[model samples]
Target: MGHDTVETPNLSFGRGATPDRSTPYARYVRLDELHSLQHPRSKEPAELSFIVTTQVMELLFDLLRHEWTIARQALREDDLPAALAALRRGTHAQDVLVDSWDLLATMTPQEFNSFRSLFGEASGFQSAAFLHLEFLLGNKNAALLAMYDGMPGTQAGLTEALRAPSLYDEALALLARRGLLPPQEASEQRYRPSEEVAAAWRRVYTEPESATLRPLGEALLDVAERVTRWRQRHLSAVKRTMGGKPGSGGSSGLTWLRKSAEQDVFPELWTIRDGL
Candidate 1:
């Protein structure tokens, strides 16, 4: 018996022409392409988990960048509510990112070692999306830009992010405009904690009832803490899987990750607590 092929009818909703089921959802989300992206080099079953988790983290990284950019723009427009909304959304996304470690945590050292060599020079250290996220969060390093020298698209995106005012930069500007921060030199240099910034945070905390920035400051603190937690968790994961050994991609591994984890995202936010 021969099976006959029949075209499926288009399922259209309200306005415009009807979109067929085969094309609508698949075309919009590109689920096929997305699912095809995970190409693990190792035959080890655990490598699938590793690759999928990493790709998920990369997607979440892009989401965080998008949310932060929205918050930054909202702050520039003096729309505190909108900015806070976006930051809150980011905190939710960060929560998922932190939880993602659970998947990789299940991988035993033997499981990871089975496929580690297959990664060659690939490392999370080279993730441009994560680097841009850090840049948007006010952690900028000119030397890091060199990592993408020949890759023009990534290099250009990084260049723009480096030059633009960071999320914290816009927050500081908002504080200054509201008579919270003292006038200081405005430079596009990387963010470094200062006594002046700490003092401004103290003011916000001392009189929370009257300060409109009180909630915003708290929201920013939440995000900073979550990001710090992610770094710490990453350090733990590396330590658990590979001790003090060098990373697969020329990275300093545990040592470098420890230093990064120890560095607070918004320094003044935490330092101000000591005075309070």
Candidate 2:
């Protein structure tokens, strides 16, 4: 029998080897680099917790985007089962994202302020990863392109995401292919709820031939619901810690988040529920 082998990710940390028994696993996982990235600007007890939670959420945002991209391509190929699987995995990741708020939920306003100023103009609003995930979910905003003008690669990637078909767009294209709606095209503009889309979803719920799309609809709703839950949790956490204070990076904090939380991720899916 022949064995196949593949190269592994470089684990060179320049430490050579250490006495710790877990060095092998730690090196493989790059735990040293991961742990070192958490630098607390303040000696305050809660600052490290804040930084770690933020980093964890950012990493999860990248994971969620990867899964959604796969699902979007799967939908484009009319691979319903593949898309559903990716969406389901995405929802589970979203659930974890929502739960991440637990780490910061108890942070008092004083504790937050202790290190808030240290962060200066930096803000989560500036996370390209989160913005990319938003675009993948069909919440495009061309105005955001200016935010990354200094970073060419980031700007170009965002531009592509802004122009490419989102997961929801591809899902609608799948429905159109089944003759549920007229042909669809990718739109860079933020998705607005359309009566046609709502009616198509309504038919998916009631029509016998549309049975195959039912699970996909339900899976999308799952993803949408988790999105809402995550945003609401973020708002709750921020309000608890900042109390309407202006966010870093010139954002309006609660006002902006409140509007975001109120906007349903899949607007048509939510509206279709009423008639179903």
Candidate 3:
């Protein structure tokens, strides 16, 4: 399976808009255009931090999605080394994403309130890039497409991601090829934990004969752990800034975030722990 990197059609950064290529630093990274993107809505100093942190997260989301796409394709081809390398790169990026919350973690409620109303109805929940990252992690929700009905191109790309087999799907399929058949189609199931799947993993951990699968299992667990940590930190940051207030774009704020943090990404890998 050939992999293609997702294109950011909305950004004007790299489409022949960059300066002369003679100076590698400015041209190669589009530093001038990147710095020009920050336009804070309010006069409050805290708003600048909010805008920059959110934009940073969007960039990290794209980076992680790119790595996961490669990992998914590599797994489909049964290329273990390739898949592991991509997964390793994604985990490193994930750690940076998880830490990005620190930039906004210290914002006092007064400081946040000072600028919160300036950007009315805008929400991080509407980020297409974050949604793409979730879809790659096997957390597909078709209903999210409605939010982007106004933007057909973005919706189409997300639709492709939602329908396609995710990185976890490929991992489970690889295990099944080696005789650990999961109970259902991994692509369709939404975090459905199967005892059969757990037992298969138990064998991978306990039975030395199944040693080849251990690295993959551990790599997946690493991803799940980092994602959970990210959500937890996000929830904490929200609670610190807004408490139980309603979220922007009509979400339930802390209530919604708490639920997201509790949700497990890779189920059987955790369920097999007691046996191990």
Candidate 4:
């Protein structure tokens, strides 16, 4: 009797194997390119986390801006369903943004100190997408526009955002169209919550079953709550990492964020809540 040695066939299931494009799972997410973007300036392992977290937050901010734009436009067209959908998606993205701070929150002051110098003169305060989001939410400040003057794309986009009606502004106009708010004002200035607008929101809250108004009011409230949570989380992250230290942008870190957080997204929404 002779013993025979058998060779096993090479199974093409490993990394070198060609991907089958026909399969649904075979489609590329371009994650190879996405994952390649995290180039931390320092050798510190914590620096990678810091950079990645900030980048992730920026991506979330972009998504939020996109959703809010749709929501604002929907409100302008008097399309409640479209506006509600956009608001709901923005709320979900806001949840992600709030949770992302947890990653940075875990960093001790010592860990942050390693890469803090690498971020010289750069801060979250200079986030253009964030500024645009603020503008879209009616927190417009002309001073912030100066930061983007060098970048034409960013400057142009932010300029347009500032000139356009804010989400709350569109909502208020919709209310006016429905006779819930007073007639639209003639001025095209930045939308400030008028006493009449606040009164209308109060009515919507008081009468919760008023067909279209109640849900719209609640949707706006949900967005406001999520936005507040994001701002608070951001302030807390800054405090946790840097304490009372000045921000990279030369402003007081936590102090500035706290003040910004205090400014409500939809002022009338919160103002009406107190009366309810």
- The TM-score obtained by model 4 is 0.86
lDDT of 4: 0.82
- State each candidate's clash count: 0, 0, 0, 0
Predicted structure with the largest TM-score when compared to the true one: 2
Encode model 2's per-residue lDDT on 31-137: one tens digit a residue: 98888898899989999999999999999999999899999999989888899999999988999999999999999999989989998999999999999999998
Off by over 4 Å in 3: 1-22, 182-189
Q: Taking the tens digit of each residue's C-alpha lDDT, what string does model 1 give over 1-276? A: 499889965565769865545667887898889989988887889899998999999999999999999999999899999999999999999999999999988788898998898888899999999999989988988788898998999999998998888899889888888888866544557799998888888888887553888988899999999999999999999999988989877889999999999999988999888777
TM-score attained by model 3:
0.90
TM-score of each: 0.90, 0.92, 0.90, 0.86
Backbone collision tally, model 2: 0
Pairs that clash in candidate 3: none
What tens digits encode model 4's per-residue C-alpha lDDT throughout 1-276? Answer: 498879975556788887443434333666656788998888888998887888899999999989999998898888899999999998999999889988888888888888888878998889898888878877777777898878989898888887777888888888888778777642224457678778888777776545558888888889888888888998888888879999988998878889978877778777776777
Candidate 1 vs candidate 4, lDDT winner:
1
Flag regions of model 2 displaced more than 4 Å. 1-22
Per-model CA lDDT versus the true structure: 0.89, 0.92, 0.88, 0.82
Task: Write one digit per residue (lDDT tens) for candidate 3, span 1-276.
Answer: 499888754545676796444457877888889999999887889899899999999999999988999999999999999999999999999999999999998999999999888889999999999999888888888888899999999999998988888888888888888887743475633456678878888888988888998999999999999999999999999999999999988999999999999999988899888776
| Residue 268 alpha-carbon offset, candidate 2, angstroms | 1.3
Highest lDDT against the true fold, candidate: 2
